[model samples]
Target: MEPSSILVIYVTRIGDTMLVTPAVRALAQAWPKARIDFFGSRTSAAVFRHLPFVSRVGVLTKKRIRFKGWLQRKSYDLALVYGFDGDGPFVEYALRVSRQVIAFKQRKESLNQKLLASIDKTTIRCSNSVDYLFSLIAPLGIPKAGLHLSYVISESERQWAVARLAALRDGGAGPIVGLQIASFPTKGYRDWPVENFVELCRRIRSEHPKAHFLILGGKREWKRTRALHVSLSGCSTHYAGRLSLRQTAALMGQLDLYIGVDTGPTHIMGALHRPMVALYHPSSPSRALAPLEHPCCHVVDHPLADRGATEHTPMAGITVDAVWEKVRAALSGEFPPPLVTPWTP
Candidate 1:
C-alpha cells in the first residue's frame, strides 16, 4: 500500500499536538514519497511548520470542518484522524477527502464500519505519551522512528529570539532561565505555587549571581507571573500575555534552562532538547507525559504521585528544595547522556 498523498487530522491542545510528532515522523519514514499534510488546531498548527518531513500544515476547527471536502474529489490515498470526539466532524472530513480513512472506534457503529481501520482506544496501554501516539500508525506497518518530540525553529526565528533576549537584558550577560508559571485554566492543579517559583528563582540567582529570568505564559497567568517578576526585581523579564505561540517557542529555544509546570511550553521546551526542570502534579505524573529521550530532562514529581492523588491534590506537595536540586544539576550539566536512536532521513 504505497500512498502518494496522506492527510493527518489532529485538532487538539498544544501539548497533545506535540505528542503526535513521532507518529507523523513514522509515517514520513515509511513512505518517503508520500505528501503528508497536517491539519491541527489554530494554536497548535504553527508547531508543525519547518518540519522537514511534513509537506504542509493547516488549521482545523470544528466550525470550519462542517462542509470541507464535501464537493472535492478524493484527493488523498489515505487519511488518519486523531481524537476521541466521535461526534465531531474531523472523521467525516477525512472520509470525504481520502480513499481510505483510519480513526479511533467511534460511538456510532456505522461510522466504525466506514473506516479502513478502527483502533480501540482501550487496547493501547502505554504509560508515556510519545509511545501512545506512535501506536496509532502501527496498522500501517510503520515502525517507530523516534521517541523524542520534534520542533524546528527557522534561522530567522532564532536570530529574532537572540535579538529580543539581548534587548530585554540590555546587554547583560548571564544564564537566561525561562519560566512557565501556570498551566491552562482547567489544569490549574498542575501548577506549582507562585510563591514557590519566587523562592526557586531567588535560589537560582544566589547560585549563579548573574542569572536572568524570562517569565513565560498566557494572559491568564499574567498576575502570578507579574508577582514573581516583581519579587525578582531587576533580574527578571515578564513575557506573559505578550508573545505569540511561535514567538514564545522561539524565545524558549534560546534559554539556557527552562523551569515550568507540566504544560504546553514545557512540551515545547522538551522538543527543543534544552535543559529543563519540569514539576508534575500527582494526577499527571512524569511517567505518563514527560519527554522521552531528552538529554537534560529533570523531573520533580509530587510525593503522592503513586498514592492515587486526585485533582484536589495541591502541586505544592512538590517542594522548592526538591526542584532546586534538579535545577542545580541541570545548571552544572550533571545529568546522564541522552539515549537517542537516529531517525532515518
Candidate 2:
C-alpha cells in the first residue's frame, strides 16, 4: 500500500481524541507528503487548531452530518473511526465517503463489513481502549510509537498563559504544580478524596513554602475545587473552571509538575513531556496509556480482585501517603518511578 492520505476520526471524549495525536504523528512519519487530518467534536477540536502535523480538523457533533459531504469532497484515501460501536450512523458515514475504511466493531454489521477494508476481530482480547484502536493500524504496518496525545498551543494561547501565570506568582520562585481533583461525575468513583488533596496541599506548603498549587478542572468540578481551597486555606490558587482546555494545557505545559486522575488534561500533560503522576483504578487500564516512551511518568494502581466489579471509578485501596511518595519521586529525577515501595503500607 502507498500509505494513502489518512483521515483519523476520533469523535469520542477529549482524552480519546488527544490520544490519537501520536498516531497522527506516525502517519506523518510514514507518509510525509500525504495529507493528515483529525476529525473531532467541537469542544475537542479546539485543541488541534495549530498542530503542524494536521492539515485540517473538521469539528462535528455526533450524528451531525453537516461535514459529511465536505469530507466526501476531499476524497480521503483512508478513514479510521475510533468510537464506532458498529451500529452508529457515523460508521456508515465514514464508510460511504472514504475509499477505504478501517474500524472496530462489536459484531458483524453486514453493511459495515461490505464497506470496510478491514475490521477488528470480534473476540480479540484487550486490556485498554487505545490498544483496540492500534490493532486496526497494525495491518498497515505502522509501528506503534507508544500512545500519542497532544494539545497544539497557538502563539496567542501561549501568550495568554504566560501573562496569567506571571500575575499569579508576582514573579516569585517555586515549582508550579497543576492539580486536578475531579473527573466527570459518572466517573466520580475515580476521584481521590478531596480531603487527600487538601492534606497534600497543606504538606506541600509546609515543606516547600515557595511551591504554588494551581487547581484545574471544568465548571462541573468547581465545587470540588472550592472545597479543596477551603480546606487548604492559604496554600493554593484555584484556576479551576476558569480557562479553556487549550489555555489550561498551555498553563500545565509551563508547570514543574502535574498530578491528576486518568482524564483528558492529564493525557495532554503527558504528551507535552511534563512530569506526571497518574492515579489509576482497575476499571481504567493505565497499562495501555501510561505515558509510554516517556520516562517522567509514575502510575499508581488500585488493583481489583473481581474484574466484574470494576467500572472506571475512583481508585480504592490507595492512600495519601502512597500518593505523596510518588510525588516526591517525580520531583526528584526518577524516570517511571515506582508509585509505592515494598514497605509503604
Candidate 3:
C-alpha cells in the first residue's frame, strides 16, 4: 500500500494508452509523493509529455535491451500492468523491478492468481472505459474522484494552434467543425464512409454557408484522405498526416464542434471536453469508447442488426441524415447528451 515508486506498463495503441491516464491520476492523487512512470509506446507517450502527475514516460522499442536497462536502474515499490495482450513477458520484467505487482488480467487467461493481486477484466462493466479504469484503484483505497481524462495542452501549444489556424482565426464568420475522417486502417469499418462525410459536409454548407472543417487523422490516411480534402475543397484544412498528436489536440481544442470516428484523438477531444459528435462501429461499440465527461457530446451510433454479420460496414447503417440532425442539434444547443448512468452491465 505504501508504494513510493511505481512502474505502470501498457504497451498498446494510442487510445488504450490514453485510457490509462485516469488510473495514473488516481495513483498520483492517492500518493502525491510517489514517482509514477509509464511504460508505453513512443507515439502514445506524447499525450503524457506535459502532464504534471507523471514523473517519467518510457517508450518501448523493437530492441528490449535499452528498455531492460532502464527498468534495472530503478527499484519500484509497485508495478501496474494494464494492456490486455502481450503482458506475459512484461509481467516477468515487472516482478524483477518491483516489490509488489498488480495487474488487469484478461478473463480467458489461466494464471496463478497468487503471483500478483489483480482485477479480472470482466469485473468492471462501466460504459466508459475511463470509468472502468477509475474503478481499478478503488480496492487499494483510492476512491473514485469523478469521470475524467487528461491531455493537458501547453500555452505555447495553444499559441501554435492559433498561428497555424491564422486563416480561420481571421474573425471567421461561422462555426468551426473539426472532422476526423478515418479510424486506423484495421478498423476501417468504424469510419463513416468518405462519401457519407462528403454528403454531410454538403448539408452543413447548405445550412451554414461559412462553416470550416479541420480534417484530422494519421499520416497513413493521407492517400485516402486526399479525396475527402478535394471533395470538401476550399472549406477545409487537411492536417490528417501533418501534425503531432499534441498539436492536433491543441487545434482540436479550438473547434466549436468535432465530428469523428472513435480513435485516439477522439479521446483527446473528450479530454478537452469539446462539444462534439462521435461516431462508432458496432464491432467497436460506442458504449466502450465514446468520449467520457463531455457534457454536450452526443454519440450518433448505427450498430449492425446482426452483431456478427458483415454484409457491409456497420457505419453504413448510420445515415448522413441521422448525423446531420445531431450536428444541427449540437450547433443550436439542442444536443441531447447521453442519459447519465446508461450502462446496463
TM-score of each: 0.96, 0.88, 0.89
How far off is residue 16 in model 1, in Å? 0.2
Q: Which lDDT tens digits does candidate 1 get at residues 1-345?
A: 999999999988999989899889889988999999999888768889899999999998888789689888999999999988758488888888999999988888888899999989898876777777766677887677778899999999999998898774676647999999899998998988999998998998888888999999999998888988999899988899999999999999999999999999899899999899899999888888888899898999999997999999999899999999999999998776654433322
Best to worst by lDDT, what's the order?
1, 3, 2
**Top model number, TM-score:** 1
The local distance difference test score of model 2 is 0.72
Q: After superposition, how far is residue 285 of candidate 3 from its true place, in Å?
A: 2.3
CA RMSD for every model?
A: 2.3, 4.9, 3.1
Candidate numbers, best TM-score first, in rank order: 1, 3, 2
User: In order, what lDDT does every prediction score?
Assistant: 0.88, 0.72, 0.77
- Where model 1 places Cα greater than 4 Å from the true spot, the runs are 168-170, 337-345
Query: lDDT tens digits, residues 43-136, model 3?
Result: 6678787889999988865357235634364498888877655436666567667777777664435432533667776777666677676554
